[model samples]
Target: MLFSLFSEFNRVDAEDILGINADAAILVDAETGRVLYEKNSDQVLGIASMTKMMTEYLLLEAIKEGSVTWDQEYSMSSYVYNVSQDYDLSNVPLKRNGTYTIQELYEAMTIYSANGATIAIAETIAGSELNFVKMMTEKANELGLKDFKFVNSTGLNNSDLINHIDDGQQLVGEDQEENVMSARTTANLAYHLLKDFPEVLETTSIPVKIFREGTDDEIEMENWNWMFPELAMKHGTPAYKGVDGLKTGTTPFAGACFTSTASRDGNRYITVVMNAKGGDPRAARFDETKKMLDYAFNNFSKEEIFPEHYQVKSNKTLSINKGKEDQVKVYTKEAVELVSKKNEKENYQPVLVLDKKLLNDEGELTAPVKKGDKVGYMTLESKDGESIEFLDGSSLKVDVIAAENVEKANWFVLSMRAIGGFFSDVWGSIASTVKGWF
Candidate 1:
């Protein structure tokens, strides 16, 4: 039961800490993947253009692997040309048989949520949209996302693709569907995307850029992430501090969805808001996101609860056998820092676990034990029996290690100790028998 404290605590939901008006939403620590706040986060819902985040991830991987290049040109197919011309959908117009650089198409897809540009990037990576969808599904599995389904690289509903046709041909497959995922799954994908390809922010954070600037085919592309300072000011709203690169998705089926990241005072967060409710769905997603961000920034601050080399007060040293020394002191391998509430320090207690392999039947180590050897791990438990679990199902813990070395005793020393112990036992037994008889 040494580590049972980790699994026995009641998981307290902090959902009541803030109110978010959305169908599915989640806020997580970007670096540690800790769940800050969640509301219906595990419910699968249409993702709309948020699907493009996956496309962005794959394209970045291809570029890094030398399989694709930003300057590489893609010739528009009849299908892509037709979809690009639909002004109803978000897109920059692409001319028939006119090729555009991968950089231009990526900018269009990420900044404006252009369907045609995203589709072209998918084809370039996987040779066709259907094949790209398979890759999306495979990558989702690889990222450990539980609730997700990807039917296309672009999050456009299958109905939209089916309706948009070129030369009497269907644009999508026979099954009509859109990409769907839970908020947790979406957040997990974002976590892996940022962890693997951090440079993506260099491009995604661009507020505005012109496609083919100063040319006849030029189009002004403004980022759809209205949370950005420039975009927020343009709409006459106050900008949220440290808001930056991410993606937004909106469609009649999916409502309004946004996956956003923000940083302040050395800490960063990833938040997702899906199917936000408002007359202006675009504004609603941002409004809900602000509530979650405010909660995280106001309540949580990093603190070192336990310093390095800290030892358990109850058990300072462990017994060792067959060595020159009788015991060895063990302490934490490093300091333990937690992004916890200001007043929650009193609730935490340390739990230590010893490695069974190092011990014999008497629960003592058979040395020679070396300095800095890993004895086990030190975990924590809440005194109130209520704890907030991590998103990745891992305990907030640190390794426990031996503080010094203990060399094995020589054979002569061992024989002398054994003979002294035998005479001492005989005298003690005879004395005990005499006392019992009297």
Candidate 2:
């Protein structure tokens, strides 16, 4: 079979996400990190509460690593506690010395988009709000989010910062830049959050929750994301009805931004729409998102390869050092699925490459192969290729692993296999000679 490589490996670019009217937008396959569509996706803009996604992500990481716990009581600082109680900003009312569980603060920020609550937790995790914002920026760097510089835990604008910052104190960095993120960066953040901490959906997807029970401070909060099924059923276009979280953001600067995720059949997708300008910005954001989601769901489809097997489709095997069997079968960790535009699935072809490190000079798998150890990779290549410049190095690759543990073959077992193979070869040679003579 003849294979063509994308001469340049160009990725889906601004021109590909045509008809999406938002200032910046992106549509991506969650499983593959494949950019199905993009329009000015790397143009950085204020992300508003969408910054909360990073805040929440880091908080979850802190909890998971035992740096913080859901049950621990964290007291509020004046910077985080008093900012919005007297103002009209988006906040969860807090009282000085009124400590709350980290879970309560997380829910307040995540479900309600409460800025005060978010900053409170930020302080808990990083000892200072300034340090926490640094952590968010560091994470963006680690994730390769090229167009981001996080200034604050909440995506509040400069004018709004007055409510949070007192005197000349830093709202973000000492220089005072607002939180900025590109549509591509926002979508990437959503992908990592969903991939790593799926439990967030348990809170983000909920329509409403009570922050505190049987207390005067109890606040009934509602999720602002309209992509939830309850709201989607009423507000969404037909193709966008099963929308679930990621997050929503809006500010004078951000202008009605929303990051959305949806799952249908066996595929999950992330879509981001930023800065729907002018009249009814919120509606414009949602409208643009509906169009993007509609196009994505109705047009693309997933085709699974290796449907009958988890094992790599190869003759390759790991040589056992001391086991009954001479070799062990190697397999992929999971089936590989390719997402393509409708009717284009057949063009994606699998290319399996064995890891050079796993093989000896003789091209045999080395011994001490434990089950589940990574052994090789399976990559996808377009029958008609693209530019390598835009291709993600990891997008086309999936892991190949040992199918079962292979210990060193004992002397008796090795001798037996060797003798049996020797006789079998001799018999085949003798039979071939006899047939030729006849």
Candidate 3:
């Protein structure tokens, strides 16, 4: 249902505002799915190794469902063996018919972006990379991702897999085509990944790990997401505070991209940068991402914009008919808290919308109303002319509920009210006729 809301938002470029030099980028409040800033974020482009995020998601899901196990061993397939030997790609060597546990391969795929380990996991889960790609597409749709396509599980260009792909496997686009996604959908994907599989952070946070350590297959794996404080400290990049596990992608066609998350105090932000500019694509993506993160952390603060039981200015009560009370008080069921721009608190306003199902012909609730009954919803809107858009393509809203119960009026009381209403109308009509005659 929320997927349909994606079409309503108009894409606006905010590149100049942040001096972001990239083909596409987006920044969002990870906790609330609120879009903080965006630039060309709707343009679909190659996502390279970032495709692994979906693979990681599905693998976690499969493991959770008992369809796959971390300790389960996968025998290296011919296709996997060939791809593993390709030194041109990022990989750890796998011997022919060699067996590796799901946990070992998962760490290699996640920490090192190992193409062979990724394909091995793909085949282990879906029997082939082709089937895994289908799963990725279906899962992307189920997650409400917009402007996305998955041709390979490893995010490598189809051309790279032309000779080594499994029999009967076909690519989705041209030979050069790689998995593609818009920055907005990518951010949405990350939001769901973090929300649904928070345990992923445990693996992604590892700055350095040895794949199959203490054996001949052992290889040191350094996280591609070098923006994390541990890696940044060692590599001499700006050490971003609270930076943690996420994914990065790069290719000749895709340039450089990173889907990164960071937290400060209690607030967290998800940022995606695609096709970053400058001679060093790797450094450029992180630099641009830092700019966006800096803009967010410096400008925004998590604030309780509206406290619990906050009543709307005008529509604070709902009229009740045939009840002991004339009306019932309605207020927010929960606090409306979100990451908001500091010093611009005046820009937001709460709007109330009542439920029509509970209203009678006279727009009043009939009889026995219970406290905490959901009567309406409260949504925040920009009082200023500026447009506010959420990453999920829907507005932020909270339930508005009744503050107390209202018992039905007694039969005698109802009869008396009806009689009194009938006489009042008769008297008013008679007086009007008398006045007209005079």
* TM-score, one value per model: 0.90, 0.74, 0.95
Compared with the true structure, the alpha-carbon lDDT of candidate 1 equals: 0.83
Could you give the candidate ranking by lDDT, starting with the highest? 3, 1, 2
Candidate 3 displacement at residue 144 in angstroms: 0.9
Q: Give the whole-model CA lDDT for all candidates, comma-separated.
A: 0.83, 0.75, 0.87
Looking at candidate 3, what is the lDDT of residue 328? 95
lDDT of 2 by residue, 69-164 (tens): 999998767777666474567777888779889999899888889988888888899887778888988988887666577777888765566655
CA RMSD for every model? 5.3, 7.8, 3.2
User: Weakest 10 consecutive residues, lDDT, candidate 2?
Assistant: 1-10
* Candidate 2 residue-wise lDDT at 282: 72
Tell me the lDDT of model 3 at 255.
Answer: 86
Model 1 regions lying over 4 Å from their true place: 1-15, 163-174, 236-238, 417-435
> TM-score rank, highest first?
3, 1, 2
Range of the 10 consecutive residues with the lowest summed lDDT in candidate 3: 1-10
lDDT for each residue of candidate 3 in 12-117, tens digit (9 for 90 to 100): 5643699788988999998988898888888777799999999999999999999999999999888899899999999999989689999999998988999999
Collision pairs in model 3: none
